[model samples]
Target: MATFRAELVIRNASVFYAHRFTRVNLAIRSGKIIGVWEPTVAGPEAEEIFDASGLYCFPGFIDPHVHFGLQLGSENCSDDCATGSTSAVFGGITSVFNFTPVLTGAEDELAALYKEVSQSTERYRTNLFMHLTVAEPKISPKKLVELALRYKFRSIKVFTTYSSSGRMTSDGYLMDLFKATRGTPLVVMVHAENDAMIDFREKKLSSDGPVKASHLPYLRPTISEVEAALRVCLMVSEMGGRLYLAHISSGKTVTELYRHFSALLGKSIFIETCPHYLYFSDAFLKGERAARFTTCPPLRPEEERQELLKHFYAGRIHTIGSDHCPFASWVKEKYEDDYLHMPNGLAGVELGFVLLYNLLKSRENEISVEELARMFSSNVSTAFGMFPQKGSLLPGADADITLFDPNAEWKVTLDTLHGRNDYDPYEGLKMKGKVDSTIIGGKFVVRNKQWVSTRVS
Candidate 1:
């Protein structure tokens, strides 16, 4: 028997890996997992030991879709990297891939995008990565190459709507962008929706009277998303490039993608769905608090929400992102009579982990613990090329881990959650399986549901 020493040891934890659970001792040194062995055997000694008995330990979540320090219309996002990442850590996320907006006709588009991302990196407490939005006419395939080769960014975000923010990308240009990133490590993340389809519907609804919250679902129906998703799948398939559909809200789109699953298999086709989609419904859009529930690709019918859960349990949806675009409540109030003007986003980064975990537990068991780990962390890291380093609990991997207490129950409130936003869509809703502790880089940022360290000066 040999003796070894490590900086920290997480002992007797219920660790989820692959498709099952194992009780082991995790030895960590220099912010990396050094080994996983039995505590009773010849194992490493440590300066600090955490007894994680009865708690579940999974790899820290890696949120793939987030907008920090973002602006929508006249409203600036309430959460910046400091606040956003702090909230993220509270929810068990140790790393994030944020979106940086680049508009068309901007001189040196990549440089501008770099500046946006760089500003956040300095403020983020957890590991940070970025995916860029390339505006059409201003950005070209050559620019995409420069982004990938020079910036080392592995993904580009293209939207089919929100032209006001210069977020939209036309079909032709999207295909071109996909083709450009093809055969490379780069992935094209499409915010799937038909701009014209939504425009026509909004105009049709507007003719009746002033736009109201109830008209949201009518203006942007599930068909708009399905049509665009199918199109992106076809283009990516033809181009033989990787594609990631962000914030997918409907089952029809998932069904369409699954139909082409074989064709997209080796091409690295991936899909991301948010907690709001799985839990909320369009009916909420008609509620008195309608403005609070407003988001692009409006939540679909309840049945469709169920269908998405089925796909997730069946292992069809590749990853789950918070799409944590936070805005203040007053931003929605400004659009009272004009619902279309309301900012489309929610503050869910802090509650994402508990919401997803409780959703599965409430529904009859479908996904395994390992599968849950994959959806929240591993798959995201693998998709964005941050794998072994950011998503796994394997030896030599970064010591980013989350300790979850399945028996812990708590009520959702703005005070209980960490974020800069003033409201919580999930407010008053009781949640089970709270994050007990969050560790990043072998350092404790959150312990016992409280922030132990600060990234802000």
Candidate 2:
């Protein structure tokens, strides 16, 4: 009688599934999950065994939106893919979806894409996926379609605001994009905010005094997000294509979606919210450190934040992304007087797992460990078309897994975190949970909260 052997076996892990966690042992072979057994099952011999008795094992987290190594305005983000993905793996993320430079219809498009892919392979440690960011005017629809179909890029992201970068894709151009992706599995992601409304408010508000952080929500009002959301949702429904709203920050936007949720359910409209929107309010922008909290579609009032969380717990929110675009402290320092000049992103990927865990713990009745797993991993993978390959722990799935200790305690500080960025927005915040280990493709990236294979040095 021949006996089967696993390459690696993990014992006594609380594996997350559907809406519950079950204690199980996992067997891995050649970078695939070969078996899922009851905790007491010990049928196979393995080359290596890891005991994870007190830990919760989740599918490796997949962040759907991250801007690693991308240049924003005059400066680049502090962390490139290698450094940024290192931080991500420390927080249990094993895969990420980032953007490439806007497709400019010039230069060989395929060549540019190959270069981007090569650069990613060289720079990122985690499994990296890319979305082509194309502006309305600069893109050639046929070329875009060719690229998407050929490379399986699977998603095209267009901003409804940020006209300064010529990224504003108007209704007409958006229709064209939808038309291009029709009858395909490809999706269109939108950064929805009314450009005209934001420009008007910023102009009116800055005229009086230096644009302060407190003025962010006012400059890009909830109405702006709601209006743009309504438009994009309608376009997606009318065009019969998928649409994803990125970094949704307003209860108003949620309310609008809720009104039409039933009709849009099978229509493929997904909503993603960020941790900052869930935890902090616009008041975080009140003091001298306002620049630190500045993000596009800026933080809303406390009441709105609560409402958004309610929607999240009710299963209305599709996924939670970090929108992790980090810059050095000096870049944030450059915009002391005016909010508009402040870099429009924050770093949170390394803190997202714990921060969200604490939030769900406080509201246990509304969310469960399994649901949190879906939001952080499975849902993102399904949306971006990386489902069973990257987000599942079932047999035959890729051996990407995260071991977490719900009872462990940790602090958010520069010394404790691994990203290249110099600032920690979550500084001084105490978390009740910690990442115990992270595995990517059966290889240990983090073990016992210490770096293993992913460390560059």
Candidate 3:
């Protein structure tokens, strides 16, 4: 496998740039993109070859935030590396940053989980990376950095919302964490919704009787997100720690990022938003649809959605994440009246690229597919310090590439999709452009717009 050469080659493809899509031919050698050269430079001794038939060549997308540690015992979420990577490949993603927290109740079990991953590297399809949420017991930020400087996790997650002792860390503790991890090149991903504010709002909502649709946005007000964002940004700024505001849904929070942004070496602030925030607003959840659209950092009004898109167009937002939590939609059926009880998070991993693809094309001939690549693949890799090697088509880079057909048409249906979650928020939505094929480390894991998941030496 180490000496493999050009197992598959696609010529005449529209190469995707961070902001536009263009034409190019990609050559592979031993699972690395040896060159992006002309067809005349293509070597005939390659194991296999194909004329892309005019498809879009994209560096495989990276989903910067995902939770694979979620467990339901025997009914555990069906997205382990095998299925998770299969789904990612379907969306043209060759790398994933799976988020794991020190398990809430079982502090001693952290080592076991770590061992499981360490022992099962080949069981996964794509090149998987991870971020461990630092726990006070085993992973205080300082110790976490030692683990990182030794073991090297790409990032660490911190929760500011949940009140449970194991979930959310105190602000002072968080500040110490930033200071401790400073200069380690560890990326701190924050779930920035103020716990105290949410507690106050929850009490108020409980006193207000049956939670109605009107209380959806009221319960988790924008103030909670804004205040948390401000505080976290201030902490990072003061201590000079690299921070990525994870799953930023509010336009108000994202709008202030630049004003709040300061870098020790221009590597301090990164702002990421989810598709749910960009596509569906609070308005989409009114009436019976409320349960369907539930997600943390509650979705805002349609106007805010428009504003968020504007932020992307203006380059204020750095990356887009699915934040693809997959609690069954029926688990939310009880929230028919009380929006407070409705489950948070909607599934969109499978639709991450499609939705963004649609948004890029709709901008009145403005943003091109190349820029889309930058925002999605290139920018995320750059933000997390994994670029050039994992996020480009340049020579010696991992041959992680996705080919999309800009004119490719596909209808997303529950039957054709694969996720442990039974429902899709983007269900019934027809989308344009899709991954025609996906290559992971020079392996054709997906071909002709379908997943060909298998063991690759």
- Where does model 2 exceed 4 Å of error? 137-142, 206-209, 455-457
Local accuracy by lDDT, each model: 0.81, 0.82, 0.73
Better of 2 and 3 by TM-score: 2
How does each model score on TM-score? 0.95, 0.95, 0.90
Better of 1 and 3 by lDDT: 1
RMSD of each: 2.0, 2.1, 3.3
| Candidate 1 residue spans exceeding 4 A from truth | 137-139, 262-267
lDDT of 2 at 291: 79
Number of the candidate with higher TM-score, 1 or 3? 1
The local lDDT score (0 to 100) that residue 355 gets in candidate 1 is 86
Residues 229-272 of candidate 1 have per-residue lDDT tens digits of 88888888777678888999988789877876655642378889
Could you give candidate 3's per-residue lDDT for residues 1-457 as a string of tens digits? 2233566667877776434555666768678887565555544346678678768788888988765535532224436666666677788878878866454433356566577667766766777787876555444667656666666677878888777345886788788878987777678888898888878878888886887655768877887888998889889878767888888887877766655563432358788898889888888767665676777778898877887888776657778887776666666665667665455666777778888889877883766556667766888888788888877877778888888877877777888677777778888877888778888888888889666668545
After superposing candidate 3, which stretches have Cα over 4 Å from the reference? Answer: 1-5, 17-22, 40-44, 72-81, 103-110, 119-123, 138-140, 210-214, 262-266, 335-342, 455-457
